[model samples]
Target: MSADPAAPRLSASGAHFSVWAPEASHVWLCLFDADDRETRMPMTRGEGGVWHSEATGVGAGARYGYRADGPYDPAAGLWFDPDKLLLDPYATAIDRAFIYDSALAAPRGEGGDTAPMIPKGVVEAPLAPLSGALPCFRPGGLIYELHVRGFTMLHPDVPEAQRGTIAALAHPAVIAHLQRLHVSAIELMPINAWIDERHLGPLGLTNYWGYNPVNWFALDPRLAPGGIAELRETVAALHAAGIGVMLDMVYNHDGESDAEGPTLSLRGLNARDYFRHAANGQLINDTGTGNAIACNQPMVRRLILDSLRYFVTQARVDGFRFDLAPALGRMADGFDRRSPLLEEMRADPILADRVMIAEPWDIGPGGYQLGHFGDNWLEWNDRYRDDMRRFWRGDSGMLGAMATRLAGSSDIFSGAMTRTVNFLAAHDGFTLADVTSYEQRHNHANGEENRDGHGENLSWNNGVEGPSDDPAVQAARRRDHIALLATLFCSRGTIMLTAGDEFGRTQQGNNNAYAQDNAIGWVDWAGRDTALEAEAFALAALRAGNADLRGAAILRDADVAWLDESGAPLSVAQWEDPQRRRFALHYRGSGLAICVNGDGEACKFLLEGQAVNVAARSVRVIPPAR
Candidate 1:
């Protein structure tokens, strides 16, 4: 291997390279220059299947991969083929796209089989000589959830090659759109190295949503134009725009499924230790996938912590949203409050400053622990989503629940836990457009006979299911969308808006389009009606501009005043009555009074003391009369 003299070695400056390769009898370091020529070097095997090489010349900007010699036993999850060229789990950069070749799948040393199936590794590229330092945006920031590919895939202004890559997102036009949206941060869906599910491949579909993570350190080559350097440039561009990037990480499980699944990377190396198993050695299914990561174990926790540190310090990632976060806390009895993984993450100086949002549930028993997370961690408020949906859909006995959600759900997030990441919709569920367009999930296109995805959508089709040409139905859907947006913005917590939700993007009722890479899942930027889209965009901008709406406070001066129908402070009867759905919430912050009319028909309700700006068939925020 050819090593760059200027590149920093893993052992230099307290850095260490590690890979789990239990089956490998011997492994070699193979470095390459920009010309793709090999620079061969030997690596020493350490305890517990770790291989290390110390050299001063090998630093960032060096191109390298690994070669292993091990048994190829697919049945036992050992797919080790050193001749196929494997990637380093600690690799910071990838050189090229993974060109699928059937020949690579064949058995080694055959007439047609060139080599064994080996994972490719990439070396870090040299830093730009004139690249300026980028600022790291901190936590307590508003994160705009978006798909890198979907965000600009259909935008009229974006170039074709740059459509789904980081370069496209950093394009001036795309950045302008984000700047106009006024989001403080962007929480990107899983961008780590991933593989399309086997089922998706069989159906000619792709895992466009990228939730299946294969390598925690390497960025997915599909999302980068010129490999790792390109990603760095993209991060630099986003940082220059003052927008931080938070990755939605899937650490609770690996891309490898259960015992029947393919032997990809980690599982193939060490399944018995990496994966959580029952006493009988059966894989745990807490992640709803085939297996759950053993986070309670020391080595597994170390791997997770190492991955996080690499992203934050090396990749310059600002924060992370842990997928199936409760899995990270599971132990022998159940979910442990004092899990060492959680403690280390909280106490770590590098991670402590970053935003740690959790999808605080798994598929395991007693997994839906929404508000039970410890201090300094924010949770995805599923309760808020359900309550908000019910109240807007005109469900009975929902008014009280709505109040608690609107005020940041003090009942759930009691004590030191304060912040809640509230959202009406996310990537896994129906889009805002689908919410009002379909009562039943239409996932038949997913090639799973419409049985996939959640059945309990809590959606209302507004008198007719699916798409309708009726202007009245369309108008009502629009009104409901606006109402939900208003409620989301007015609620007392950090709000997260799925990209394109502001413009009413739809997935044709496919709530779980994780496998669909077509136009159905891609954001239809060109189809947006400028007039309507502009109005919605303005509403989002307005929400972001209003400082009082960003997060919760102590309500120092009783900023919120609840009023009954007759212009009086809410009485005991009015507050207790389950039938009462219409009420006014006057907010003193920013000198605004928001009147919510939840009833089906518009009622002429009196204002408490002052004349307020009221609009028919709408949730109106009346600013103080100046």
Candidate 2:
């Protein structure tokens, strides 16, 4: 386990606040009143670079900030300004949302005091023990990825007051929708409090994705009306419904950008220790968010682990999906799978049983650590996404790759037990409907022209781009969409479906809709799209009813036979053939034969010694002659 830096302990009498600022000459605790007035008191410096202070009047519900008097040197990566108020790195709750201003990020000479404008931290009362038994999340369970606001913001059945709040999602109508798909877990995308990026002001956009975080521990007020209590109630409700919750967490970077970025919390408290920097003190742009968090540091590791365990014990969350997890495992040497933070999470007494998922890649050097997260950790397989896309889009020479992903990507994740969290669409990319209905990403609304999203989406338009009135093209898009989702569910390991992808949700070809908070990003519940919804339920039912598909252990070669159209396992020469796209997969134990045609035209397959013709860009599921 990493060294415990358990400072800022709270008690009934008052709060014990301790900060690690070795360079500071003096430090003061600034307690704020309801009227926005601050009562400043000097803090004494302790051993090991920690400054400690305890105030009898300051307790839970008190709003406070910090003032550290240290050298104003940016060249050495120290930017301590007494006039600028800083947030506690261990703060449990924040008073309000972060409102970014240009003056907050400027150098001391160029900028003035931001305390008046910056949000203050609020000390929260300790949480009560959870009421009811929680659902246990494990491999092979279905995950429904959603955004709290967008998931219920426009939900017709949800009350207007509850719209866009955590409680809104726990409504019976919303839970029924989740229950319809048998979602064993819900992966909420970043409910943590975050500040809008400075660049978005001019474009009149907001950080709808909640990736740019200012407070790691506070829940976004917009998403949680009653704050942490509201979230706990929601989780308890979901647990009662037999569904677990997994939070999508961002520890890779802070809302603070490069040198010109805001001081916010950690950056203002201790920039050098909180974030990664080169030998010359320049910030490392690993997360592409300006500054990458130095998770290798003991203090930062404590922050992450402490926050995780807090959610488990206080909020009763089942697991977490770490965003750009490579940043957490990075070191001065390079990316290490056995880094202290990773080891701590794996061995932590509280976190060991929790479901740990990794995004698996970052923008740093050797950042792509897919299939390298050791054991007991599942990964979002980009290989599954790409191969499934290429094969279904009628791209030739991909049959072998497609076969590998369907069988749990043994070529990549070959540790015996399946750790692949396979999905055709997630929150970050194009929807399953859009992937087959559009060729190019139309991200004009992002205000970055059309250069914002991924260039190569490996998508197909099915003879028409974006929304098409052509019935033939629409039918083809629907066919491809259902097939892609079916493929995802039929694959080994766990399967995740985006909230509206099952019902043919479209972002109008906008792959990266992170900034758009309007109707463009919200799920379309008005249009029921019953056909695609049924396909989703069919896939869920297929996984639940078929033991072979959701095998506890990795399916052995004898369990499945990847056969050619002639109803026989493909020969070495046939498997290598680029023109080979039509194949029948037979689950030997389950007596299920599925014929997948990836060709541009329909193909005939001999199933159970009986000839059957399958359409192009489609999948045919049949009982093996009963």
Candidate 3:
């Protein structure tokens, strides 16, 4: 644990407890007995607003929480209530997962004795730091984003006991699947402890996606029953097989939500200092989840850095993909590329070598900072996704856009080394199969009446709204999937494939399946399209075998020759022709040619006197001459 030495540490007699609550009038370390009885021990106020306490009898495995006594002004963002037990921000292990209760949201004095409902931080001894080789993943590698539970819940080989847990990932069947995909890293989506939204309990639904995080350091008990050790062991197992792991972390907001939300860890401890607030003293809603963490604040930055270091030192994971990353760089004025938190992360020795990717947008003002994260970060490129879909959907005037996206999206990323993580589909939207099979979102199961997901998905139904018995429709969808995957694999920079997207996973057109913890969200391993899976494997192999395709360098005019179907250099008129859809990009140095035909008719392209035929709505990668 690279966290501050003041963090809870076990000694010969018992344990030393410490907390940072500068504004609180007093703080108490509450330890829970076997029967859930609480004993509050007074903590002595220390320098710099931190409180310290020595528990002579308490040792490892002791369930404990903190109670801070201070102001209780909601409007002024000073939420403090001794009734609401708070989890330690430095807690590495939690006794149980968080479940939403209406009482958790009740006002300070009204929500009496939340200890019964709240999860306690289990006192733990820090694991020895891992020392090994650098991360196995690198730029321009395939990143597979998957929810831990959804990915393995249906796996027949994974044990029933181990299913849907971090330990399950170490199973040989799972590692074999990853190896088949040639995955450089598997990005686990938000394994941190989280609470369900208050509305979900009433709707008979719960948060399936773990995006609503409550504690940054503690692993979700449901995901890792063995706690941090399970993660460390799983990571070691994956690394031994040449696969890296990346956590999709959420630092934008806690599950504590708004004033009406639950008084979890940060909100109950020091809401005024931990969360960003407006001039009117209202919590800032930059994250769309209610309150955004004050990343610019020194304590918040330290916490975030400490969390990152703890994961690295303990688990030895490859890297991280920050969810809604703009929140990390947002200051009082606006989002700054050189914000203290962002700069510190980039400069941190432990984190500098690790792969860092950014979601790159939020709902806040100036939140869509795509290419502004400077040189150290790779960003998820929405433009690539949109343009690729539009082009394959047969939208007019998308030839240039499609070519740009396939060429590493130079227009968006204006650097020598493109920082784009191009993908045809992601977890939050329609799957690749759904993109070709559904024109509208069907999310009534989510209780949102199909109005929750993105309205204009730039998708096509291919003569059917969803699944169809028509072989022609099925063939068309398969062709489109190949085209989409080929475009992504043939692109210049890093690529990401959401779990099951490689094998035609569909949410029945439910784009926003965040609340679907049932069969709708789990990857149907048995029902997956084997042919599509084979195509994905072949495409991955193709990308890996070709140096030109996997390189991160932005293509220049000298490096690539843009040609029309006739093999002649593309003219101004041809580039401007909206109706034209066939083109070939021949990499001059590698002698490789990528021929794309977005038209509904198969087209043949002449490359250096050799004719290469490409199917309609498909892309063909032609190898160089012998």
Stretches of candidate 3 above 4 Å error? 1-6
lDDT of 2 at 459: 94
Instruction: Score candidate 2 by TM-score against the native.
Output: 0.96
Model 2, stretches more than 4 Å misplaced?
A: 1-12, 129-135, 611-613, 624-626
Model 1 lDDT per residue over 1-626, tens place = 22211122354543234455666777667766665667656777776667666644665556666666677655544555555455565565555444334444445443242223334465454343332233354323356899888887788898887888877867888888878877677888988877665567667777788777767777787787466566567776888888877889998887676665555456645566677878766788898778888887776787788778766665476778999999888887888767999999999877887878899998897798887777777889989998999888878777778877776777777753257888999999999878988999999889999999999989999899888899999888888888887788777776788988877888999999887788888899877646556766766676666655555642222767777656667787777787777667766655566677787776665664554544444566665546
Candidate with best lDDT: 3
Which candidate order results from sorting by lDDT in descending order? Answer: 3, 2, 1
lDDT of 3 at 526: 95
Per-residue lDDT tens digits for candidate 2, residues 1-626, read 11223435577677777777777888888888989988998988787677788888666788888888778888788998887888877777778888888888888767777788788888777687553343467798888999999988889999999998899978999988888888889999998888888899889998999999876778888888588899899988998888899999999998988888888778777888988889888999998889899998987888888888888878889999999999878988888989999999999877888889999999999999999998878899998999999998877788888887888888777767889999888998898898988888999999999999898898989887788899998888888888898788778888888989989988889999999898889988887588889988888887777766665366668778888888888998888888888787888776687788887788888867788888887877776444
Candidate 1 positional error at 451, Å: 0.4
lDDT tens digits by residue: candidate 3, 266-356:
8877888899988999989998888999988998899999999999999998999999999999987899999999999989989888999
Candidate 1 minimal-lDDT segment of 10 residues: 1-10
Better of 1 and 3 by TM-score: 3
In model 2, the clashing pairs are: none
Error of 2 at 240 (Å): 1.0
**Candidate with the greatest TM-score versus the true structure:** 3
lDDT of each: 0.72, 0.84, 0.91
Clashes of each: 15, 0, 0
Output the better candidate (2/3) by lDDT: 3
What's the distance in Å from true for residue 358, model 3?
Answer: 0.6
